[model samples]
Target: MDRKGWVMRAVEALRLATFKEIQRYLDEEGEPFSKKELLDTLKALVAEGLLEEKEGVYRPARKKGSAEAFRRLFGD
Candidate 1:
């Protein structure tokens, strides 16, 4: 998987994670990502409604119909 995929996987596995936690998970998996890269990816994910953030903590947004909406809108 790519870095973004890994990021999503890490967040999904953790359910809720801080920036450092996501970074650590990626590093432990032998895929060290730059801080800017991770943050940028997270920002995009949040914008796409694939993820959510609160007080710098991040989590996958598990809302019904959201995935379908995203696929329709973004053609994922």
Candidate 2:
């Protein structure tokens, strides 16, 4: 998947995570996304309305459309 997609999936699964948490998760999955790369992707995702960030923690944006999108893809 693309960087945005990969980051989105990570945030979706995590619900909320700090930058390092996301990076560690990706690293565990063998992604090797650098801190800068992850930060860049997070910024882009937030700008594109795909993710949200607060107090340096990131999560999938929980707007109605995004929630429905997740439900459709993952169920419940």
Candidate 3:
């Protein structure tokens, strides 16, 4: 998957995470993205309404019907 997709997966798996935590999760998944790359992807996801951020923490956006998209992307 691409950087955005990987970042989204990291957020989904973590539920709620700070930047360092998300980076660590990516590293643990063998996807060692640079800090800038991860940050940029996170910003894009938030902008696209796929993710949400507050107080430097990130999570998958809890939009209505968004779970279907998540299921399609990541399965049950």
RMSD list, candidates in order: 3.5, 5.8, 5.8
**Candidate 2: where is the Cα deviation over 4 Å?**
65-76
Better of 2 and 3 by TM-score: 3
Candidate 1 to truth, TM: 0.82
lDDT of each: 0.92, 0.85, 0.91
The superposed Cα distance between candidate 1 and the true structure at residue 42, in angstroms, equals 0.5
Report the lDDT tens digits of candidate 1 across residue range 6-76: 89999998999999999999899898999999999999899988899999999999776878879989996
Ranking by lDDT: 1, 3, 2
TM-score, every prediction? 0.82, 0.80, 0.82
- For candidate 3, the clash count comes to 0
Q: Model 3 Cα RMSD, Å?
A: 5.8
* Model 1 stretches astray by more than 4 angstroms: 66-76
Candidate 2 residue pairs in backbone clash: none
Please give, for residues 8-76, the per-residue lDDT of candidate 2 as tens digits: 878887889999888888888888797788888899999987787889988887767777889979999
Ranking 1 against 2 by TM-score, winner: 1
